[model samples]
Target chain A: MMVACAVLPAAARSAAGPTNPFLRLPMVTIATHRLVLRPFRRSDAKEFTRLAGDWSVASMTSDIPHPLSEGQARGWLKPGRREVRFAIELEGRLIGGAGYYQRRSGTAELGFWLGREWWGRGYATEATRAVVHYGIEVKRLPGFTSSHFVDNNASAGVLRKLGFEPTGRGRIICTARGYEVEAVTYWLPARYAVQAQPVMARAASAGRWRAWLSRLAGRPA
Target chain B: MIDAIRTDRLVLRPVHPDDAEAIRAQIADWDVMRWLSQPPWPYTLQDAVDFIGSCSPDDLTTTAFAITHAGAVIGVIDMRINPALLPLRGPGPHLGFWLGRAHWGNGYTTEAARGLLASAFAAGVGDTVYSGAFADNAASLRVQEKLGFVRNTETLVFARPRGREFPHVNTKLVKSAFRTA
Candidate 1:
């Protein structure tokens, strides 16, 4: 459906901006069956430092350093204009972190790190899927890119479940490891959710519904 | 800003945790799930709870309502900032809705849209509203037609439930053209 802006006379319209409307929005707390992926809050700083500080967890991520410091953890949580970061929580307890950082090329890069103790339970996959879906369904991002050190087999399995396809191999420094390591890059188009079909099912039809809502005992939605 | 709407046959209200079971019952149906762009297939109670939890009075980006008849939720409707429109223009409300298959053909959908659209326009957020349905969802398209929504664009929409794209027709309604009744 046409938007209100189009109804205005040319002289009244704002300076033409980029036409594509799909861009990062204010970070929103995304929820899935097993997780609550939310913007990091100050109260979480201590737990974040502890989990990300673990040697097993820090070693897997590219930027997080060993002995993750309160100062460094605070730096990661700083509100950013170009990226959306979420602190992954399970049952009100902090576990890992997942979110995307946008590139000037107009695509977001998805990244995540889970506590060593929380590994093997599929929380990484579950948390990352929420981020990906939020990128596609809510943010309208065109695609996402991610990489894992080739040696991190557990991480590779998680990416596979999210349908991230191999793009190439490259070297990225693992700060926790104190050196560069071989990594495999992967890409997943936002379109993957709406892949090739005879017709675009349910895409772009946000107006396919009508109805007003009444308060449900002061509930949301 | 709109918190509640009352149509002759329906009370469009905020979704409640109590509505969780009913929302799951209808949305899990392939008949409804197939038409929605979001909401994964094999719908779970957790998904329903998540959706309800996501709704908030303060969130200007999305406003959702449960379409209730006789105090029972039979459907859901929402208007939210169309992310695609946020750049070129501003936050334009995108309207969408779905009902249990059993509730179809009762004119309830149209009634709900009228109440919500009128309230939205009255809020002075925007003068026009955008909406559309899957090409094959003629019933949904017809509902838009009744509200004075004219076809504006056509494109493929990715749906999570089907895990594949399907053709969709997008439409829009201006305040002046809406059918208030």
Candidate 2:
């Protein structure tokens, strides 16, 4: 399925300014020698809905309810108080989501889920690392935390490789699975003191323009 | 005698009986108590004492520590573990914390959270950490997010009191996505 593939216009990618209160640092578009991380677009709604709405994705996540709908996917893309929410772009396609919510506390939580077709390709790990870097270097956050179902070894393995140490667990009601599952917690201390290059400046600039146009057009960014 | 956990900028120790007045004053403020789940209204010194006395190392399930900045206790950070649960039965620990209103916007909670998280990780306590806040509690939620806690889910009916309702934004932090900067 081609899904939504509308490219945001160039004019819409450069109209951002300092007065743009919503404009953050930049959407860190990380390229880890393999994948590209970019911001979400309105066109991505169809595919995002299809992938995020899938029972498989829902089954693994505690928050994503089953019978996923386009409205929910669109709602997920809407800007909230959090600063970083980006689409996991691989080979120029929106495959998943990876970003930080609760941007100010010097620690932002990272969450991401790939479509079933995109599974086993290491996209989740790549996207996760990119976001972690953004949180530490670009955002200058001090720490970060994440968790997964105990049975979701893949998620756990990704966190471990990123240097997160497990510290606790809790019980969560997985609505899609229709049962409670055991979740393991992990944490990573903020050690990015050296300040890396501004990775997301371009994406931020482009995203701001798009957001402005979306507002102008009365469409969501 | 209160055991103190000292960091470069702050000291985390135990809450004492005499500290009750300060605790009461802190929690009684609407800015602080508004986001808290317990202690409805009319917060008193007795409430502070009860809170302190309830915290014991032997409890194993919950560990509450008083946060002190410049020699004065300013807030509290705690870890809640479910002994009856699995995964946690092995190597994971859940965490939660709060700072007094006077201490807001100063990175105190973040400092205290990192210190406690380090202690928990260093001890080989668990493999992951989880925490949450009310959806509207932006500051508390921001602290957890800054620490890399992802949104897990939202609970509709977390707790209800006399003619009042409380919902929670349940968030979790897995080990795989953690990075130290």
Candidate 3:
């Protein structure tokens, strides 16, 4: 596992070079207190398809139609896109996904989901905090917008715990639901983005040191 | 082979096609690329191949070398014309370099950059060498200052690895002010 990629925003997408635009960045790994947020690997397609494919996982978000196929999962995991995605891994098992989507020149929207089995463990909060921290500290994204389907109180609580203030309510297309669903929207300004206790600093040192040691010992990195 | 420059602690030599994997492993890092002004994110093997293919020992405009220690490619250093900055900054080759994340904090960047700068200047690469780091990249700025690169201005520059245009501290070193040691 080469394990290198970036949380690239829009402008940097094409600056990769003249030789090829088939841009695949090394995965940029994000570690939390108990979880690891990493780039989605090609090998993750099967697990991701099976997990994100569940109606329990897909119906809440604006995208990700239910019954997601392996091919669709593979396509979603492909690099070279404008947004940055991270596979939320807990104890080396893929639990769900989180990332910055709709990345514009300055800000991006936040999104995530977990398999039903993985929900309510505060895993979503921990993973999302790390992602938000990366956005604020690393990407310098000033603001982010997110929403939860009206009935999904779990997501609503997750957003509220993260300091997102409800901006409005509207019927948004839920590709998974196959219709317009009433969604309550919220926004997180930079000020509110600061409280996320990101474990990135410590994780970088521990992870980098471990990775360096492993490489020195000729282990797979 | 012919243009490899030897320093007290390192070897600065032409980037080779065979160095693709090492180059990829090191430069693909966010820790490395976050400060760079150009180049793609996620630096793939093909980009490494293309970069090595574009390098020329004799061409100052595209002078690039692999920094080696113990005969292992540990990093890369290059000086190339920045077409984007050429109009605004004027007549200078932009210098850029990076070491493997594991190799950092060892003063290898200072050592390797010193070696490359000495060679580039001796070959009459240019009268002026332009360099800078992201506003937040203090370590890199420190290296240039140690090399006698005087600070010039600050500008917002777009760097892909950072995923947005960021504040860049621009510096320039003239042939007269160049510190080779």
Candidate 4:
């Protein structure tokens, strides 16, 4: 995707002020080599339903309802007025989502979920790294709070890989079960978030470099 | 929209502009506002209006109410999901409330909070609700204790009004324990 940005008209590329190298870059849609994290769109409803509606997916989450009704996916895709949410896409296909929700008190929490087939590929971690980057590096949050069902070892692995530490235990509603479930809470400090997956950082920087070169060479891209 | 909840001694109703005056009067006093984490120290009528403006019960993230006794606003009670954390997917709204200084020590805070918890749990909002109180605020802590909130952790939380961090005890109430409590 970064290399693709090299083909844009040079005149348009240079329109961005060059006084600051970073300022010259375009708004990030959160891309890693294997995934693109962007804002959720209404058109993604069908795909979201197909993936997120699965019983396997819904049961693990504390909030997502099993048997997601028709059109409900679109409703979930609606932008939160004050929250940051994103759709995780692979080769332009929607696969999952990740983002933070800021409370009225000005604190925020990190949450994410992915389609079942996409599991075990490290997509959760890579996508999380991108969003966490946006949270700390872009949104400038100090850190985020997260949790997982004590029995959901897969989710625990994802949180652990992202550098989150167990803070304590608590009971939370599991919407899928319509009952409370035991869960372990975790808090990831800003310093750990700053160290999110290096591969994502390298991929993003490489894209910026290509864009920068295109602008410098006065090429159409 | 917020449905009015009637406790034995208080009415918990959705706040509106007309109630702003009473809200300001109650919260403007430092004695009542000292333990609050947000809303500036010197609160004003406009702050009350803005708060009511954002108090829609239909919002999935928050539910705000005016705690009334004998048809007069005495304080506010609310629950909100911490916006920063993304849940695996469930309602985990945190509990918060405050009463006019004069209304304290009468168990009104405890009564109002218990009623709110009952409503939230019945509606399938979550299996548990979380709350916290400044370590020094024995009154607030007592209310939690009376409602059967178990201490989960002790952490330093920022007090926006005072511009400093203070010791606080985080608490959680499990739904199953509601019957026993």
**Which one is best on lDDT?**
3
At residue A89, candidate 1 shows an lDDT of: 74
Location of the lowest summed lDDT over 10 successive residues in candidate 2 chain B: B156-165
- State the fnat of model 2: 0.00
Badly placed stretches (over 4 Å) of model 1 are: A1-27, A136-140, A189-221, B1-181
Candidate 3 vs candidate 4: the lDDT winner is 3
Note the chain A TM-score of all models in turn. 0.76, 0.70, 0.75, 0.75
- Quality of candidate 4's docking, in CAPRI categories? incorrect
Q: Please give, for residues B1-181, the per-residue lDDT of candidate 3 as tens digits.
A: 3478898889988888999999998889887887776678778999899888877766756768889998999998888885535433447888888888899898999988888788788878878888877767889989998898987655445465544344466779888887767
Clashes of 2: 46
Tens digit of per-residue lDDT, candidate 2, span B1-181: 3245677799876556677887877777776766765554667778888887777754323557778888888888877664322111223466767678877888889888877776666665666787767656888888888777887644321121111222356667766555332
lDDT tens digits by residue: candidate 1, A94-134: 88888776665545778888877788998888778767766
TM-score winner among the candidates?
A: 1
lDDT of each: 0.70, 0.61, 0.71, 0.69
| 1 or 3, greater by DockQ | 1
Query: Of all true interface contacts, what fraction is found in model 1?
Result: 0.02
Residue pairs with backbone atoms closer than 3 Å in model 3 (clashes) = A4-A26, A4-A27, A5-A26, A5-A27, A5-A28, A16-B40, A25-B42, A26-B42
TM-score of each: 0.51, 0.42, 0.46, 0.45
Query: What are the candidates' C-alpha RMSDs?
Result: 14.5, 19.1, 16.6, 19.9
lDDT of 4 by residue, B1-181 (tens): 6578889999998787899899999999988777987677689899988888876668534758889999999999988775432121123788889999888889888888988888888778878888878767888888888888877654334465654333456677888766324
